[model samples]
Target: MTHTLLEGKKGLIVGIANEQSIAWGCARIMRDAGATLAVSYLNEKAKPFVQPLAERVEAPIFMPLDVRSEEQMQSLFQKIEKEWGRLDFLIHSIAFAPKADLHGRVVDSSVGGFTQAMDISCHSLMRLAKGAEPLMRDGGSILTMSYYGAQKVVSNYNMMGPVKAALESSVAYLAVELGPAKIRVNALSPGPIATRAASGLSDLDNLLSVAEGKSPLRHLIDLEDVGNLAAFLASDRARAITGGVHYVDCGYEVVD
Candidate 1:
């Protein structure tokens, strides 16, 4: 029997596009653990996709959200407050880097591409964490996803690597800023996993092969691993863990 890890928690999970999305995995597991889910779709164009995924996760509150705009972020949170009053957790499973930047050399990355990538991929979490703070009456967990490219060089990762570096740093700073309030902030960094997001990177084929072969697990990272990790982080089990950029990468980081 699967015991409900989050028996009475309520939280928002932003950025699930489909079942293959890491956000979807988190939502599924979070729901299974008895958490009520509030989901945010990025835009109208995404509504069709987000609606179905939210249904599958049994998410009760679904709203439109675009992290690039403060208005949308504030509006979404405002609605959440009106409906739920308080939130127990927040999952920031959102990130984006342009296809052009991910397929070329870092030197070839343009100013526009770099800014767009960082704004959407990194700044969004900082925005959400700031926005979610007031409503977490009971100190709760805030989670964001990160990739291995942030710490080590991965060919064709481009500007997004720098963005993830900034995001990883934000986890620490937010952890410090929110710690006194009992809020925990952390990032779950995972290795290669085949999903729509990974499709943008040209090196995905070889990247997965190398990660699977060299990592101690000798297998590609799985979404189940990520979902379970999310459940643990959101629960009181990890109350003492904060501001950490924890690796869920099947021992890949330890290998030289």
Candidate 2:
């Protein structure tokens, strides 16, 4: 059954590529929890795939937002300001790295590849938070997706491991800086799943199998598992919570 956990709240969800996206999961859950949502698609090609999902949540503000493009990013927040006047939370779930760099050893990652990955995957959170800060006049939460690789090496995770490490660190620094304003910041690190983004990793099947076998739960997590936690963190129920790298990894992070 749907709940009013987020009733009267307004949130912005960035990084929905398809139905299987982690951001899509969060959007669906937050919408069900009574949030008014403003959702973003990466570009025209992604609009078609993301539009239906946004409609399902009755998102009043649907637009294009490529975090790499300052113009697009600025336009998104401007639209939100015009339509909603305020924002209660922001969900950032986008990350990218060149395929060659991602599939290779982290030590061999090139300057361009590392820079692109860091900019899109880690620094984008800072940019979005900057835009959301003013709109969050009453305070807000900023949630970004991270992974286990950020803290520990996972074979084939490659350059993203370091990128995510930086993201988690950014979350801590952001939490401290924004705390006085009552703006909370945290990272959500979910276990392996077959999402489109995860497909980029080499030998993903093996990774999933290994995680399931080793995890205390003996299975991988689904989008819903991640969504449930995200919805909680986005709501006032977690008002006092911030500066954490909360895991929805089914106890996988606890094992050897």
lDDT of 2 by residue, 1-256 (tens): 2589999999999999999999999999999899999999998998999999999999999999989999998999999999989999999999999999999999999999999999999999999999999999999999999999999999999899999999999999999999999999999999998999999999999999999999998989999998899999988989999999999988999898
Give one digit per residue, the lDDT tens place, for model 1 in 209-228.
99999999899878888989
Question: Which regions in candidate 1 have their CA more than 4 angstroms from the true location?
Answer: none
Relative to the unseen true structure, what is the C-alpha lDDT of residue 27 in candidate 1, on a scale of 0 to 100?
88
lDDT of 2 at 123: 94
Error of 1 at 42 (Å): 1.4
TM-score of each: 0.96, 0.99
Q: What value of lDDT does candidate 1 attain over all alpha carbons?
A: 0.87
